[model samples]
Target: MIPNVLTIAGTDPTGGAGIQADLKAFSANGAYGMSVVTAVVAQNTRGVGSIVAMEPEFVAEQIAAVFEDVRVDAVKIGMVANADIADAIRQSLDTYAQCPVVLDPVMVAKSGDHLMQQDDVEAIRERLVPRATLITPNLPEASVLLDRDVEMSSLEEMHASLEELRALGSQWVLLKGGHLGGEESIDILTGHETVELTAPRVDTINDHGTGCTLSAAIAALLPRHGYIDAVRQAKKYLTAALRHADELDVGAGHGPVHHFHALWNNAPLQLQGAQR
Candidate 1:
């Protein structure tokens, strides 16, 4: 069976982040993509202007609607703005717990605008984090979860944060190092094992939906590959996207990664957004 990946996230009208990016990432990683929108964000590569969250009951209904008919291979959760949505997702996910869940703890936008409520942090930690097969967090998110100042300037710090984040609950934790400026970007993965993946930093201003893309890619690959192989493949795909991100020329500020770089540029079938 083809792996069908589901993304539960907010919407970005600009189409670089949120549900849009998840869809692109899933498609790029060879999976059929589906989405349940949690919020409609009035934002762009520059920053978030405003957000309108979906009702808790409605979000729960969307989850039910999808799970009832579709055999989801994996679930990627992002940008659940409030406690109600968090609770709704956690409660609804119980029926689909057999499918692996990849949680991308998206608390803020790349432009530093807070996308999640401060009060909802505990709810996510208590409810959603435990159920997650894998949790991917950057330095700031890990710091918020641990309630401490985590400076991820060094590999040692990244590993420590990984351990602390794993303690909060998650079968595995991936601490992303993109936030830390270095010649090489390193991401630390811990749980069943401690592994560090590093890649040369791609200097570009286009990284709007990176976190969502990486987590979604992981989910997309899980149904077909081993945990380590999936993560490795995701890293390779993300790196290529980052390297060619400038070609998109999306906005004046940060743009999106070239998610369909291979498909639209060099593959046998030249699949564009609508065509896919």
Candidate 2:
């Protein structure tokens, strides 16, 4: 059977992040995708203009409907706008506790728009983080989650931040270091053990939905493979997706990575280390 992955997030009209990006990543990684919309945003590659949050009850119903009919292998969650929506998502995951979940604690958009309310951050911390199998956080999100500044000055600091985030109940933490100023980007995976994956930083302003894509790819790979194996696959997949960043023209500003690069080119996904 095809692995089914579900994404609970807001809708991005420009298809860079949110549900759109999750679905794209799932498909690119050989998983079938579904979505439960929490909010609808008038956004593009440039920025978000406005947002309309759906009722908590409606979001619950959408998740229930998918769960009732589909054998969802994993879930990727992003962009829960308010506490009510976050609570609803938490309840749904509680209802189906066996599914592996990948949480991308998306606090702010690449355009610097606030995707979540300040008060809801605690709700996500207290209720959602513990339930997630893996939490993917960049340096800024890591700072917010740990309630301390994460200095990205060195690889050692990045590993320290990953360890701090792992203490926050996630079975694993993929601390992304793309925000750090460097010629190479390093993402450290900390859980049962620590492993670092590095890639040459493609200096492009077109990286819009990178975090969303990474987390979703990891979620899609988890059920079929072990945690460490899936993380290795996800890192390899994301590196190629980043390398092929120049192939798309989805929007006037900050286009998404070329998720379909493998399908078009038929290149093998390469991993830097052993697959678990």
For each candidate in turn, the TM-score is 0.95, 0.92
Clashing pairs in 1: none
Residue 256's C-alpha lDDT in candidate 1? 90
Q: Which digits, one per residue and each the tens of the lDDT, describe model 2 over residues 1-276?
A: 689999998888888788998999999888999999999999999998999999999999999999988898999999888888888998988997578999999988898888888888988887789889899988888878877764466677887666568777989888888888689888888888888878788877788988888999999899899888898888788878878888766788888887888897776555587487
Best by lDDT: 1
TM-score of 1: 0.95
- Model 1: residue 79 alpha-carbon error in angstroms: 0.5
The CA lDDT of each predicted structure is 0.89, 0.86
After TM-score superposition, the amount by which residue 47's alpha carbon in candidate 2 deviates from its true location, in angstroms, is 0.9
- Each model's total of backbone clashes: 0, 0
- Kindly report which residue stretches of model 1 are placed more than 4 angstroms away from their true locations once superposed: 267-276
